[model samples]
Target: MANILLVDPDDNAFLALKGFLACGGHRSTSVSNARDAMVFLRENILVDLIFIELKLPDSTGLDFLRTLREDYFFQHVPVVFYASKTTHAEIHEAYGLGVQSFHRKPYLQESIEDEVAKLEGKAWYWSFFEPDDAFCRRTGRSLDERGAALDELEPVIQSAAQAYKNVNIELAEAEKEKILSEISGFRRKVREVAVPGLEEYLSYLASFAKESDWNEFKEFAALMGYYAFLCSYRADIYKLERKAKQASAVLDRLAQNALLRSLPPHEVHALIPHLRDYEIDEGATLFKQGDVGDAMYLIDEGRLGIYVAMEDDSEPKKIGEIGDGDIVGEMALIKNAPRSATIIALKDTRMMRMEKDAFTRATIQSPQMKLAVQALAAQRSMDSIKKRAGEIDISAWSKTASEGVRKMGERIPNGFLRKDEKESEDIKREAESMDHWNKMIDSQTFPVVSDAKLKRDIAALKGCPVVGSAVAAFTLATEGMVTSLHPLMDLAEHDPGLAFQMLQNANALRQAKTKDLESFIDDARLCVNFLGEKRLSVVTKGFPRCCESFMYLNEGANWASHIKFLLATANIARFTCAEMELLNIERAAFLGALLHDIGKLLFLRVQPAGCIPVYLHAQEHNISIRESEILHMGISSRQMAIQFVENKSIPTSCKNVIRWVEEPEKATEDFDLVSVVAIARYMCRLCKVGFSGETTQQDLLPLEHSQLWNSIKDRVLQRFNVGNFEILVRRRLRKF
Candidate 1:
């Protein structure tokens, strides 16, 4: 039976898992938290597996796992995380900490059993965790003794190391041949010299060479061969271990460098494994002018000179020098061109090489890195252009220009190109505003519903066969009423839910646009016609399915009331857009109005009883529905609606209007469209056209109070009469 440690604070969860594991023929040890688990582990009890609840009294499951992994004994032990509520980010962190498995607590018992069964057949080995220390440790002989005995091999080892380093650096034909010869001589010397720790064995073989005792000599020869093999193997292992440690040190330095400081830790971690270290001799040419570039190098030690060839076959001139922590050869790699200038080491140097493919992969995962690279490349290109411009014969070019042109140039003031204080202040203000908005977006956190749950709700709604027929009948009746081509029939035969939504949207538009409330007709054809064929098709295809889902999930009375509010808002938006004429997006405005509260529909579907508490909370607090929803769900209804519509094939304009309707000031591009929809929604809420699940009235801000509204008010007021529009809306609200 395998020994398992279970860490959980909840007594019920602990007992349930303990009992289940016992039934499965496993021995189990239980603890209430990470602290107790640590104490239990220190008792030297063997554990084959660990089951940890993400939440504990003392420390988090991830923290416990991280600390456990640091202990050599538990590094190979399998860890399974169990939690009732776990986010994707948390799950990612658990895996990053080397967790073997993750499962939701108190569920998926069978899957957990399967995972355990598979582990039983697997062989556990300590060698898999780390390399054998004996293979890397030196022989028992004193360092001085070994050094004297291997005096002939010391030069060979240094030459071999130098050859390996040169494999990464660019070299001339003569230098390449010299390094290759050194490597060949080193290999030959290693085979000829006596191996360390095998000197006595070799001496015994030499003495027995002339002896008549064949059996004794054979034994001596075998011992000599075995010791030689061990000495060679240990030497290779030690070299590899040293190299790995060096690379790791280089990675640590790179991670903290200014160029990579802005990258996320995970992205920087991904880049560490791909970096390779190289040591260059003093005055070595790293690369030459016009040579094809395949990798970029980071200077770890010493300095390098950048040189450019002069015109007419003159000698290459040193333009600049880069010291430690600077990167070079990146421009050629990024541009996919030959080296712009030759690079040569000024002193004995250590560098890290990152290949083109690895650099491309890294930048793809880190957009900030890509931007920084581009900005640097642009600055270098501009510097090169400026240097070339300075060399040009300006007097020759000026002689070709007209006298009047030269006179005009001479008359211009030197300080005329400088920016005025007002212009400079405007630029600074714009920059500050963008920076503030970026921080605001980054800091805001929204509650994310899983895709599986949302899909399941949609599927359940679609499976209700009655919704489709009801929607089709309502569509035909509404069309007939708007066209005046058929008699008005009783609404009982058709789907009341569909008919109610249609009537509300129609009347809402009429009240917002017309001077009289009586002029409003309860019809769907008008909305469809106003949307035009393309937009109408998009709305008709998706909106009906959504409405059916809402009807299937919610009570009829509540669904009807919610749809009425949306319809009234849509109608008001259409009227405002038509009257203002500033934005020619009447169809988009109407569509935005209808879908503004779509997020509420999703909330209702996910939790049918969730709205009751939200409304009650808003009523008690005397707040708006948006504010109440944010308090209850960690996001406003507008954010939820934006997430839902992102997956649909709707027009971007319509989506933007819906997204920014609640906060018109945030609409950077479609300000007019967003403002019109916002005004209409606010007016409808003020009029209380239908129940919006908000029991108490919310305070309304005047149009003049908003910066966005004030900016466009003069233009709108010049053509439209706001006083007359309010009178018309008040009269229309009396009927509702």
Candidate 2:
């Protein structure tokens, strides 16, 4: 039960407010005017809460609030002013005068109840005292006078009890009830209630109790009734005070817990009021895989195992482990990513859980700190991997061979420090390296791609480390073709061209003495410089062109037949070319295989912007090129010309290559060229082959024998290194 003081000018408003307070279990006092309120306070001043209306009969409510604030003792007590549609300026002014809150007039009954509850709920240390009223109330009654009134009221109970006993003997129960009801009705109507002068206060008192303990007063039983009401009222008010204190304590505890969870150890110690010790048992599972998780656990003691389910097995595999002084489940908590693994206690563990809300607040306050912690975790993971590595054998012959290479790299001049740095850098570097190697070995590392498409896209491109080596070798082996291009020779004649002439002179002098077949075999450098440029340019661009040709969707079958012809041309070019006799057949075959898609240059270039058109003719110069009679006639003319040249050493004419290009299907799968061609064509559609398309390799190569490795043995080997192929095939076949 709260002790409410309602200060309002309207009589009806005062009565309504007083009645409302009574229903809410408060003993309310009303004051209609500021002057009379000051007088009442001088007489009695124990107000738990004050609700002053903005309007008063005599003066402004704001002025009274200012007066209350000026008095040092009244500053602690909360004051809520009543208003009806107050403007922002008025509200700001009221708060400036030290009012705690405000209540709008004509509010719902529940709203009034909420304001009263707020007052009662507050801790009692800030309530008003006697000095507050004495400062302004001109009545000379001191603090002692108010204290005396309370003391005097305590003794009135015994005298009232004796009068009530006398009344019970004289009056029947029915008449007593009737008299009480009539008195309640009269008091309800006639009460002026506001803080009036002492004379006015006494006048109402006199009317209420005519003759104290008289024969009629005893019969009415008013004395016992009044004493009981005073006793119960004091008891109820005390209970409310106790409940308010308990609520305040709970709020403080919750605030402390929240602070501790959000802050770092040093800062947490400075902020939290107390630390609650917590623990967990061994084999305890904090969270399981696939669970929606929020809180993260901080390990204080004991070990934990982090396990993830294997891709091929139903049971979980132990991927990692952690121990004291570590934090777990944080990744999922921070990113809301799904839980990657399950954490189970390996030993009895003592840990603290920082809830999601606490984590969010902490992150908002210190983003840099979170990143530093992640960096530390990565370092720890690497360290653990190195530790585990020491216990594994990994000693197969192939493994031994790779390790030997690593060892040799270690022994290179100044190599000791490089190896040492790799070994000594924290575990994080090791974990990163492990993840990288695993992906690289599986081909899953580069990006998922079709074998044929990847080969075609990379064919004869010198930028890649592997392809660059092949290009350099080819350039060195084909230096004899430069003499035929008189235009390029004239362009290279002097001054800054001195370097070019010197190189050509050096190669010409070396070729003069290199006459033996074996001597010529070792002399590939001059040959490569002669014609290597044109061949490489064609091969480098083959992948993209092949991809375009294979990507035809509207008339794919016709395009497939066109691809078959290109493969035949590639095979003839590979085996029939004798000028490259010094190099082994295998090297020639690899070059042939890579060049199988060379026709795509002419094919896709003829397409508009090299785009795959709905009708291939949109990009093609002549839509009938695939079926023209000019193709067979041109090939016949070229063969006749080649037959008339007596020196077989003379290179095949451009017309011969073009004639072959015209009738693609007429060329057979003779030699390994056909297989190499099919593979290049396959890579064209499988964009992941890095050829830039949007479908699977299978869509591009639908032939029953689309897997064309056997048909083009020489050309295929030149593009893909044997060592890399072995590694990839072994990895893929592990399941089998």
Instruction: Tell me the whole-model lDDT of each prediction, alpha carbons only.
Output: 0.54, 0.40
Tens-digit lDDT track of model 1 for 1-736: 4666778865445444543453354556578888888777655234557789998888899889988887543455678897767899999999998887888644333655776786764423222212233322434444333334345455445444333433333332334445445434544444333332333333443344334343454444433332333334334434444444544454555633445533333345456667888778889999999999889998888889999997876689999999886788998877888999999989998988899999988776554366556656767433332232232233322221222222222211122221121223334533553454345435643322334554455445421112232333333323311433121122211222333344444444456667554443433444434433343223334432322222322221244455567667777788888778755678667766765565665564444334555555554555666777666556665666676555333346656876787677777767777888888876665554554555533222233333445555653557576657755665555544
RMSD of every candidate to native, in Å, equals: 28.1, 35.9
Supply candidate 2's per-residue lDDT for 620. Answer: 29
Best by TM-score: 1
lDDT tens digits, residue span 1-736, model 2: 5666667865435444543443343556667777776555434344666778787768877877887776433445567787654678878999887787876654334556777777654523222122325423755554344333434443453454454445543343445555445444433322211122212322333343443423545433333333233333333333434433443332233222211222222222221122233576788887778777677766667789998887798798788888755667777776677787888888898765667766656554433235333433455432422232222222221232233222222211121111111112223433543454345434523222233332333343222111111222222222334333332222121011111122223334345556422122111223334534565334323211112212334322323333333333333334333222323343333333333233333222222122233223212223232222123122221232223222212112221322232233434433233332333333332211122211111112222223343334444435454334323323322321
Q: Candidate 2's error at 579, in angstroms?
A: 89
Which stretches in model 2 have alpha-carbon errors above 4 Å?
Answer: 1-280, 294-305, 308-334, 349-736
After superposing all C-alphas onto the true structure, candidate 1 shows an RMSD in angstroms of: 28.1
- What are the clashing pairs of model 1? 508-571, 509-571
TM-score of each: 0.29, 0.21
What C-alpha lDDT, on a 0 to 100 scale, does residue 84 get in candidate 1? 65
